[model samples]
Target: MALSTAPGPPPPGLSAAKIVAYLHGPEPYLLIPDPTPGTHQALVRWLQGRQAVAGPVVARTDAGASLRWARTLLALTPQWPGTAGELLFVEDHLAKVVLFQDPLLAGHLSAKWLGRLSDMTPRQRERMEQTLLAWLEGGGAAEAAQLLRIHPQTVRYRLRKLERIFGGSLRTPQARFEILLALKIHGMAAECARLRHRAEELPARAASEPRRDARSIGR
Candidate 1:
């Protein structure tokens, strides 16, 4: 599968007739960009039209972190809705945390859900994480702002920023669920990393400690 920066109708041969051939048999393979709602729905409709046979496993992610998570999806043995007309999408933006809702095989992948956040400063990361979690949990800006001790306008600003980063996932109910899961799992991963780092430091610190020999001790 080739990744293209272009968006819109997928390059030729992506119709129901050619999807399987392109994906599995090769020759004219699937070439799609990060899909927009228009493209996603179009693909959905194309698959819907072929609702007789089991469909192939194909998905697109609009999340900013998709490139990184793409490695995770590739590492797993993929499966798609065999019951034609079903849709599959993989993205860190939302849905069961990272696309497909079927937790990939990685044991420590919750960290990947952080996407770009992994590159952010501690304060920036905390604020973003808190804003998202509060907004989702409280179900609105006002409540979230109250919880975060900030103005609703601040919450709205943070939300808009998150919306831009996550793309269309913020607009759909299913996507919202995914966004929430991403936040939850990211926090879990961050904590795990902290613990792992601390554990590593403990061994090093222990090795460096000064020791008193039992023979040198005198009562």
Candidate 2:
């Protein structure tokens, strides 16, 4: 008996179980009956030969397997920094099968960077957030100082304090680039939650409104 193997989703007449069995079988054997002699038999032999070659080739090239290995390494060591959820998400996204296999990039973010920002006092975080927004809005140190109602030197000092807490050389363009992205993502998430809450409030507000039109008609 000759075997048939098709790539991707199973053929119309085949079930998933049969397809899996064919792919995972120890030897390169097709479930299909042997084709006729001459041209058909030659084609079947060529296809079987290709299938034998393809199985090992796919296993060698599997990106998911490589990602699993990288995840295992991360699990074994706590050297990589950041929130566990953040690290896992970043690792999974960057380790997608389509992306060429490479070492996990999440390790580049230091542990200090991933530590709890909540450790900073709420006032400190609020001040830092204001300074960041001002800076992002193209405010110079003087403008930021005016916005915060602080001296220019105080603005500079607070920025330095923020840099220390964040654990990155924000002075460099490259470092600033990464930090800005992280900050923007965090801000957007907060904004989205706020907007969703406001949207939920709107329905209740509309329901509570007095029936002005009906009252006027009755009057």
Candidate 3:
């Protein structure tokens, strides 16, 4: 589950004050103090929002466990000076629990990982996503073309373009994993964005449209 550091309600019956008290109570002593609050805050934010540990129990040591988990995960992250990020893939949290953070893994996955998609024409990027997904689905040009509803020649041509863009990564196992996983994550994020957009429109939609006469609107 995704973790959040936004300081929400703690487990039920657990005094809000108790949780609040611990929030500032040396949030698990850092392995090293971040030079600025950014990096540290990044880590703390990453740690937040996990499914509440079972509630109403005082025998827990979650504060320390969370720190330990953070240390374990963040320890693998490479520090890019002056950059403001240390992202954790909550989707991969369970599968990647023993996994150390990969500071640059996003790069291996897609151009969009670092907003590099902005460099590509929209059509080019769209084609790239289609081709990459088909490629990872593990097939030759004919199969990819079938999946994309395009000509085999088109698939092969796009593959060539992708080769230029991604180098030998299409053939590299680890790189393939990163690319496929990243694409899945990117797709999930986009879907979430669409949902949120629709949600945002709901309030406006209601306000702009006529209110229903309940009796006439439904049985």
Per residue, candidate 3 scores C-alpha lDDT tens digits across 74-99 of 33333332234434532345333333
Q: Each model's TM-score, in the order given?
A: 0.43, 0.40, 0.50
lDDT of 2 by residue, 59-102 (tens): 43463454344343333222212212111222343322122122
**Backbone clashes in each candidate structure, one number apiece?**
2, 4, 6
User: Against the true structure, what is every candidate's RMSD?
Assistant: 17.9, 16.3, 11.8
Which tens-of-lDDT digit does each residue in 114-209 have in candidate 1? Answer: 565667788987898899899889989999999999999989998898887777766788867766777776665465567557646775677899
Candidate 3: RMSD to truth: 11.8
- Candidate 1 error regions (>4 Å): 1-125, 212-219
Worst lDDT run of 10 residues, candidate 1, spans 49-58
lDDT of 2 at 176: 61
- For candidate 2, the TM-score is 0.40
Q: Pick the candidate with the highest lDDT.
A: 1
TM-score-based ranking, best first?
3, 1, 2
